[model samples]
Target: MTALSELNDDIVRSMSVGAVFSDFGGKVNSLDFHRTADLLVTSSDDDSVRFYDTTSAKLVKTTYHKKHGADRICFTHHPSSVVCSSKHNLDNSGEFLRYLSMYDNRCLRYFKGHKERVVSLSMSPVNDSFMSGSLDHSVRIWDLRVNACQGILHLRGRPTVAYDQQGLVFAVAMEGGAIKLFDSRSYDKGPFDTFLVGGDTAEVCDIKFSNDGRSMLLTTTNNNVYLLDAYNGEKKGGFSMDSSQNATIEATFTPDGQYVCSGSGDGNIHVWNINNEPTKVACLDSYIGVPTCLKWAPRRVMFAAASSVLTFWIPNDAKPGLESGGLNSEV
Candidate 1:
């Protein structure tokens, strides 16, 4: 893959698919990259959680939760552990929200406060605190050290929540293109700022802050991704994705915060450059199923996308002998 050289704007536009891991039998729901551990984790509808080594792009471990059926997954500060939201079968035998230790297959704790399916789950960057947004119309914050929720906020429509890179601030995106910012320290006092990009009435599917915390990405049910100014919620530019399905699309920011990448229902990975006007830089095609779930590597020149199969990507100008270890076939 592209060595860790100075990443310029053209590197992302020159990327190509490097590896394919088609081990999962069902669709992947979400994925997270560890901040400092160089690991990538995924939870899928197939009732499985898989971990991969970012250096080699090899499968490091795979575990299953047949009873709970894992959905959205995020890594806590501890590299060996993760917080997973369950798909939750009708019988209610599964843990809705759980702290799982992937090392020895242990369920450390169960968070049972949400009454409906949780749609968004995010871990704070600087602490054990995590947030979950559910169909029950609430955003609940919890600490890994405690089994109960530490704080809660009730709101209208589906909520998507995320913590800024510093974990000192958080943003909540809701119906009707409204974004509310709250101080992590005094969230109980409610939002200190709110922005209304009113026009699209679709429910928000996802929200993320850039690594530098200067911009935010908002994705909605109608397959639109908007880039916004983090300071005052001004719209920069975004993509009206050419997606054939209604799957939730996620856009991830490169470590340098200069580029954004997302997968489309058409089985292609789209890259966009953020400027006074965002532009689509590249569209790398994949033969695999719809790659709805995606993420950029924390500190590498690569990104991963998944549907029924998982694909790892890198720049086209890598060393000749370089090969991904897991599903070693390069696309």
Candidate 2:
């Protein structure tokens, strides 16, 4: 087990894995945190979306999608509302885009247009609008206030979209190595800037903007992660996901934007310092099964990673004797 003192010299590491939640009974597809509450939400292959109390490690709420299920979910500014793309079964006809009320599990609105499954979804930082990327080769932008799609961008390959912190701009990465930046208000003008990463062979699986909105994280199916300047698309260095056996990994920046963390197919969670010389600081094997979804709290030093099980992470100083809770196990 590597402690904060051993890995970064004298940097005083303030982070560690805290709790393990595995009641979902299936693979967790996504994980998200509430901006103002100590609550977290997860969507899973069990055909359910679950709410958990971060502090108590208790189940707060559960909503079932049954046949079609839910995936790629994001919470809106509203406390009781969330938008999630439907996960359809083999015989289903059309996919549904839903605005669901967590209070009663009621469907508020449905926006339908994608020709295939929606693989990615992201809510705006400052508004009720959201975006979805699909295998159908298109990106759809919608407003919660309206039931219809407000705008759409047609691309050549699979797309993953994310919004900047201010909701002023968004980035779209397709099957090719190209990443396009668009103005939130006028996206139809097409991307004002584009960055080509790797070569034409690198297939990007996910993309996220830092909380500070200055740098972007791009994860590829080829076991690579790239960090790029958000404004100019300059290739600012990156770290490789080579250690992990998982071909598809999701990497994200901590809330403070000082570090980067990613999940491994070997069931280990790796954190790296992005400042100064970028290097791996810690690796935590929290007994998870191929952690696919990872999220950091908006206002705290804590983060949650999900797979077949869900793990809440906090500073090691927060829990002294609990290190034996299996956090010390190497991946």
Query: Judged by lDDT, which candidate is best?
Result: 1
The residue ranges of model 1 lying beyond 4 angstroms of the native Cα positions read 1-5, 90-94, 319-327
lDDT of 1 by residue, 1-331 (tens): 4554566667877776667787787888889999898799999878999998777777789999987888889999999899999886723653579999999999999998888888999899988899999888899999999987899999999999999999999999887789999999999998999988767888888888988889998888877888889999888886787666547677788877878887677767788777546777888786675677778887788888887788777777752223534335542
TM-score quality measure for candidate 1: 0.94
> lDDT by residue for model 2 over 1-331, one digit each (tens)?
2332243412324556667766776888887787777678888889899887665556779888987687788888887788888878523546568888999889898888888888888899888889999888999999999988899999978899988888999999986789999999899898889988855357677888887888899988766788888888877766665545543678888766777788776777777787766777777775766677887777655678877777877766656323234433322
Candidate 2 RMSD computed on C-alpha atoms after optimal superposition onto the true structure: 4.4
How many pairs of residues in model 2 come into backbone collision?
1
Query: In each prediction, how many residue pairs overlap at the backbone (N, C-alpha, C within less than 3 A)?
Result: 0, 1
Question: What global local distance difference test value does model 2 have?
Answer: 0.77
TM-score of 2: 0.89
Candidate 1 worst ten-residue window by lDDT: 319-328
Task: In model 2, state the lDDT of residue 315.
Answer: 69
